[model samples]
Target: DLDGDGDCEILYGSSDGKVYVMDHLGQELSGWPQSSKADLQGRYGFVVSPSVGDIDGDGALEIVCGTLAGHLYAWELDGSVISGFPQYVGRSAKSVCAVVDIDDADDAAEIIVHGGKSELWAMKGNGTALSGYPLELGGDEDEFDSWIFASSPIVLDLELDGSLQIAVGSTSGEVYVFNTDGSVVDGWPVATGDWVYSTVTPVDLDGDYEPEIVVASADGKVHAWNAAGEVVAGFPVTLDAPVYGSVAAADMTGDGANELVVASSSGAVYMINKDGNFMSGWPTSPSATTFASPIIIDVNNDGALDVVLGAQNSALQAWSRNGELILSQVHEAGDWIDGTAVASDIDKDGLVELVFGAYDGKVYVIDLDTPATDANLAWPAFRGDRVRGADAVSTDSDQDELPDAFEMAQFNGLEQSGADDFDLDGVSNANEWIAGTNAASASDFFSVQLSYLPGEPSASRRVRLTWNGVAGRCYTSWQCGQLDEGEEWELADPESGTIDCESTGEMSHEFDVSADDCFFRISVTR
Candidate 1:
């Protein structure tokens, strides 16, 4: 998936402090198996799953993960570390990171994570901390003992408003909802009366259009709260065992209403209705224990959704919508399956594959026999999607590397050609898309300026070149000694190769003036 080669490539970090990318045939990708110990001095290795997205607005996805050593790292697809990364968060980062577009104006998304004990960290794509972030919690003694531990954060429009909010749980038994600006949503930080290790799942349990925030506690209770932080009418439902994984939702009965799916530590899976009652054939156990979250999909190509889950017993279970076990579809693994499964048509072969990581140090990709359908089912994957963004997957109908959603939103259709300039701004539609510049405005293209450095010695005269750039994009400069026709151009700084932008701002570089007739030009390398 990282190379867009039609076959899905698996990305995972191991206990040995190495992150790897493997193709579908299990061959390692070039420049992979990047070691955190060598790269960031990471001693504790990666304890949480990695998140992928185009964090830098450079049109290519970047992988982001936090080590248990409390250092967050970002790497390009080619195994190179992003500049200014390996940012220290706190004592440790036990939670999964969420990469999302918290601010629409920025185009580049933000990385949100619970930085160990009592701080929620938010950083821009360029590895710089977002303003008013790394928000501290648990200030009052009566509030709680500790804040977020292993629970991942979710970004969604909880109020049914246009703006998104961050929702996460604390080990102290409270669910906090914060606006993009780090301000607490009115009436949030609701008490669940027990420790919460599960990520908050948003589902419209009552057909109200507004999703109800659902979460389970370690004390074997499920709680659903409305937008106003009020408990749902049916109230908290008690389960037989402690819940360690997040709850999932889907229309299991094809009744058009979502049923909450909960997997307990004892491996008991329950389907609960909105009325706080268990559905028929309830509490089915697939294995001895389970700490991984469950996902819903049409595994048999049936119109009704099916349950797919992983367990500590090294088994991946598939159950029908009516609670019947699909014995033939069950897959056994080499070790404990503690990570939630994600489904995607990675091969583009009209069928989806279920992917997950196991304690045996292997990432498994299971091909489901079901044909690919519109993945509109509730809670189809961990934290909602492969990137853990809690948003619908963006499609690229024209396969131009530009998402259809983005193209439609920005240009009204797919009529714009990737290699052609839409606004006659000297930049192609593709480059404009990568730079996050306006495609219809001729004045909004990438621009560069040249000037002489003020403090340079006359004998070593230097010229400074500054250009507006997007973070993570590589820019290369070319120079020609003469302006005559067919004159050869060479790299302005041959030893530097390409310059990687560290932030979406004016980036400057100085070159020793080689000739009075030198002409220079800057272009994006990637």
Candidate 2:
């Protein structure tokens, strides 16, 4: 939860252009119901879901979401707008934004989202566009055949190379896989023969370590493709209706193999085994129509996974792994639940709770008797996790202190040593990593400056020390009577143990000048 109180807080965006945060008891948190209409200076609301993560390296989480008017906003836990946010991307942002560490140099995450039409944007946590991004998917904007991206993008290490690859679908019926550099991966942009509205789900079906891509389309088919982009045998399984939402995978049968859970717009929920065959007692209809993806969890503490999904009939339904309806578990909402539901042990209690938002501008948190451990079930929530729409894989392949993605982006490979100063900057790569500064830019190194306030009581003059700081990085200001070699450096403000940099900018600390000659310095800490 935002306050680290152990009870999960429900965060959601409504059609009225407001974002809200509420406690588990359904009480609205203070400084919430943030209005996008006022923030963006227009009438707009969220059509896609909101994602939460520490956009900055700060330990505190920030809410990231886009509006139908095409502005992307980032807010602090208290509903305060982050500096450099409400970035205008395009005409509309209809897909969920994926917050991930695409760049590992600073340990900060990037916000990846479809900027409507042919644009795909990669924005840094500071709300600035990442270089080489906002890549045009369909080429020239004037082309009449340009594709529109509606499906949310997923990030994964498809090749198990420690670097993430982005996979997303378009209205042109094609699924694209791209390297972090924005180059299309070989054997990708594969045609699906119909519009793809579902985000690609990655599952290691053959125990190959690398995940296989599984996605459904308006063609009424579920297509499976290996890492090589070749269609898996048993082929595109045809269904009775088109799939509009994403597919969820989990070990529903406890056979150590994942079962694909699909909820179609026709209100049917089907479970297909890894063999591309439908499970027994399949195709259970929970409601008349459903645009929400199903989540697999043990809702009744029955030792077996249950499929949970919301429907246009304003009801949340649950069914056993074998497709039998959980008769006593239906929960109705005031309006349609078009978005996917997330499960967690919200109240720090042993039981898990299902949380989702509805068209009536209300968020519901339904408690269940299931064990809290069920929250860790494989693919328990939408997009495989509760924080983001996709998973970001980061690793140090060569045992270096720097991440593989950082080395690859800066040196084209892992050829540079973390102990060396790559750009001839005074700071080593390791220190640069800690300071979240650019190792390749000498001018970007961290340092501090001291200055005296313009006006203050002559008896105890005030002095301020400012430093270039990174968000989430802790710093300590020190002072010493003299610059002697053995002089001890004590905390400038002992009462305040450490200073937390809330944002990447000038971080300063002020204190009354000492009665005698003193020296001041700033040191960066973890």
Candidate 3:
């Protein structure tokens, strides 16, 4: 999906010291068996999942990730290194990142990282930092700050301007907002009682076209704050336990008004109405703790968003709005889950799939049993758009080298791959372009017919050759004597020598045969 090649690829780093890109069916793409480690020159290992963005605006997406060696890298879909990447950003505890168009000053976007140093750094797509970056948030220089590990920058247009704004929460229990130029917003960092590990999730509860920031803190409460740094009327909504995972907003009951969904470290799920009151049939217990953010999608296709997440109990579960368990999938006997989960239509098959990483060193994609009728903004927090609610979809609907209309006529249909041989000919659809033959018909191969005319005893033999010539293809005829005589084939003379045929028509060539039992073979080379 990152490449917009009309297919979704599962991208992740593994213990094998490599970055793996697999197709929707778990098949690895070519040129990607060990893309990352090899590109890094074996300098560091990758532990976190990679993010995707078309940083160069080249109509193709690039995958970005950080290494344990304190460096960040951007890779092309074909597994090639992006120029000026693998930037050495110093030591980092967890370098989770997102791409944003902080300012439309370049052809690409900036790579924003919440480094282990308890600071946020913004770099141009080419690996150079902006003028005033590495913004410090005044946190003690602790190696394991929960905020550094959990708090990621969210890009949104808080002022409803055409440009983007950045919102980040810190270990100091304060949420900070900044203009794209790195200047602080008016009412300053809003404070909470404890650490703010949850990334900010913006929801416009009052339908004002302006979104209110909803953030969960380790203080066992979910708080909503306006852009002006004032808490919403309902104040901080209390949870049964410490709220580590971020909350998701969706109208679960189809009531037009959205509900706040939060999960705690104590293995419980709570749904709070817009007014900050708990919903009926209350907290569903799945018996597993999760730090991974909860995703809201209609798992039952009942027009209400369902809850989906992986848990410490080694299971990925989905629950209905009414707190009924709909799907439960398990990993190996007792392995735990490691990262956050994202849901999207990755396969382009019109169905959504759930994606997440695991402690056992693997990335998983679980195709939901239900078909997705539309694209989901389920990835609305970390890597979502800087202004738009969701990431932009690649405009290239057909990934074939041939444009959509041309491929449709050439292959006589859609969704064609280079690997398919539609004409049942030995040549694949891609290879057919070499001879400019009809890919839909097996009878139209590049072939040559040879004919010989013997003259008087003193005269040389005349060999006439004819073929349906193709444009841009070079035709050659070779002659050899005695099939088993070890006679080497020599280039035969064509009437037109080498032709760059301008159209599809009969072409003729003549060569004089000198040796007995001479055989000729005609070949075309592009």
Per-prediction count of colliding residue pairs? 1, 0, 2
RMSD of each: 17.0, 17.9, 20.2
Off by over 4 Å in 2: 38-43, 139-149, 374-376, 386-526
Task: Please list the residue runs of candidate 1 whose C-alpha ends up more than 4 Å from where it truly belongs after superposition.
Answer: 38-42, 139-149, 375-378, 386-526
TM-score of candidate 3 versus the correct structure, residues matched by position: 0.67
Write model 3 residue lDDT over 241-333, tens digit each, in one string. 887777777556754456788888776888888788888865886477777677777565555567776778877777777877775533331
Give one digit per residue, the lDDT tens place, for model 2 in 395-416: 3434466654355335544567
Which candidate has the highest lDDT of all? 2
TM-score of each candidate?
A: 0.71, 0.71, 0.67
Clashing pairs in 2: none
Runs with alpha carbons beyond 4 Å of true place in candidate 3: 15-17, 33-47, 93-95, 142-148, 327-334, 375-526
Pairwise TM-score winner, candidates 1 and 3: 1
Ranked candidates (TM-score, high to low) = 2, 1, 3
Each prediction's whole-model lDDT (CA): 0.75, 0.76, 0.66
